[model samples]
Target: MAGNGSFWVQIMPAILFLQLLFRAVGTDGASSFSFANDCQYPVWVGVLSGATSPPLARSGFYLPPSGTFQLAAPSSGSWSGTFWARTGCAVDSSTGRFSCATADCGSGDVACNGRGPSPPVTLAEITLASPGSGGQDFYDVSLVDGFNVPVRLSPSGGSAGECRAVACAGDVNAACPSDLRVVVAGSGGVVACRSACDAYRSARYCCTGEYGSPAACGPTNYSQVFKTACPAAYSYAYDDASSTFTCVGASNYDVTFCPRT
Candidate 1:
């Protein structure tokens, strides 16, 4: 079973070690990732290595209607990166090449091949257990780059409270302002929403320049809107303390796209 908590972790050390040693991915084996699609349509899942950490076994792939994608345990070490999905993608009949309408990684294939995806993407930012962070795995859902899909994370093979699931409910994109809205061709239905930082690359919105510090740029109208819509997600860069979550000891995780209602 999986445990969910909203508060920060202050668990005992001994128990924490047990939790870490006994996780699905540990000395027993490497960490693994399970990707599930709960959306009404197909989605292409992409995972990228952060800071060129040990790359994921399958960095990119496709999940058909209600499909699931699995990967072997990751190599032992500190690994951090982002995972997201691409929508409205298909292969060109003549070229037989892969392409996505949104969140395109420019790989021209199912595999991202070390390329970064386009904006308006929902991101599952994660850091696996390492010496620096007391061997805890840190994870979160970030809307800072905008939102293309709804994401949820959970430590599935461990006891409850071991980790908290992060997911945004409801369709905030449909209500997204005209300026920030990403709509489909002709349909005019919302597909994704862009963050102010993404929409306007300025020091104020990017939280850089004189506003580089958290104290400088606390919260803007755009960030507040995102926070109000998805309180558990990283609406801006400084939302860690509240939006970020941790798992002291646990196995692998489940990254769900279009998470359950």
Candidate 2:
């Protein structure tokens, strides 16, 4: 009996090592997103899953200044989604409903419950690769909806070159054009910047009708302003050539709100 006990103890270590090795080799290719709030004020983060993708555990949550939260992607298959931050959020005393000065999801609560954010919001978009597909991950920071906060999306443990960090760390609201600026009452501050499409709603700016194609719709003066402020971000709907980034295999990503320049 004593001899048999020693034999089992010796074999246990070998079994454990094999299990760990198998886990490393058979990774599910799922990724994790780390959300960080670097701003001086608190921000409410909102997430909206793509139509074909599964929703995350919490669609929205409050993140205090310098706070961090991590969420893992679904391991079953590919996932795609967009994340953004809502600023100046507070419960309305009269109505007892939650709202934000910018990028409100209109859920009347802290959780967005799968609702997409309003315009004049900065967006971080990602489409993760499927397991064993050998496909690349696509990510970008888009200002096509507008700019409410500066965001940075950086890949970790991924391939080089195109997997580099992309950010819209510029203060676009301060330099926003008069017609495109969103000013909050009482405070009287330019809290967000509206896109030309959102502000004008014209065929040329909205890229509809005859200007639907990329060839027909080129960068306009309004988009150039956003491009000059944050060159790595998608300034307009067709700003794909320089905005989109790809990574071969990133274990995790850091999405920082109000990221430093």
Candidate 3:
């Protein structure tokens, strides 16, 4: 048998090669997000880096049916951002511009630049672990603004047993009340649903001013409807008690569009 020093020397090159590969992939024992579209139609996926943080990949990209896009985390050590799906997209033949009927970012093209999402969108949010915590990431599905599609956030090959997976996998559009429904243009069908705050725009529904505090902003009947439909998502602004999930030492995550069957 070779001595311990000799054995390590023989394997050092292989170990160094793996380290380089991991860094190139952007999951070098750190955290990253991978997006996939399972819908039968193309989907424009928008990525927004957290405020005060730098962006990783392109702001937006067109994902063909069953296509995938993987992005390594930003080099900023700790980062946070939101991801959403835009459907019913098409290029304006006359103007040669890209647009989507749902989750439109109002940039008049596939790329959203730095625009925030329009209402009636399902959002997946991730905040990587801080350096002090030895690396634990927080993730969630949020319907606080509303729901236009189903989304699932799953952690893969990581130290995330309790973290598990979270999804708002229901078609809230079909269940949306007439007063809160957003009908698509061509189909005239409910392709998206709005929150009570968005639909009503009242202080009560929006939890503003006197209702802004967590103690003041208890769940209302309108918010209960969304919570019942999506127990794992943030139904309203103050619905943070059970809506957040944490993963320790995770390698990467996969965010899926149209995750529900």
The TM-score between candidate 2 and the true structure equals 0.89
lDDT of 3 by residue, 38-114 (tens): 87778899888888777877889989878999988764467788999988888899998888888989888778888
For model 2, give the RMSD to the true fold.
Answer: 3.4
Which candidate, 1 or 3, would have the higher lDDT against the true structure?
3
lDDT of 2 by residue, 62-92 (tens): 9999999999888767889999999999999
> Which is better, 1 or 2, measured by lDDT?
2
Best by TM-score: 2
Error of 3 at 151 (Å): 0.0
Q: Write the per-residue lDDT of candidate 1 for residues 96-193, one digit (tens) a residue.
A: 98999779999989999898889988888888775223466888988888888888887754435758788876477866778899877864588889
| Cα lDDT, all candidates | 0.80, 0.91, 0.83
Clashing pairs in 3: none
TM-score per prediction, in order, is: 0.84, 0.89, 0.85
Regions of candidate 3 where Cα sits further than 4 Å from its true position: 1-30, 130-133
Residue 198, model 3: lDDT of 89
What order do candidates take by TM-score, descending? 2, 3, 1
Candidate 2: segments with Cα more than 4 A from true spot: 1-30
Superior by TM-score: candidate 1 or candidate 2: 2
CA lDDT, candidate 3, residue 74 = 60
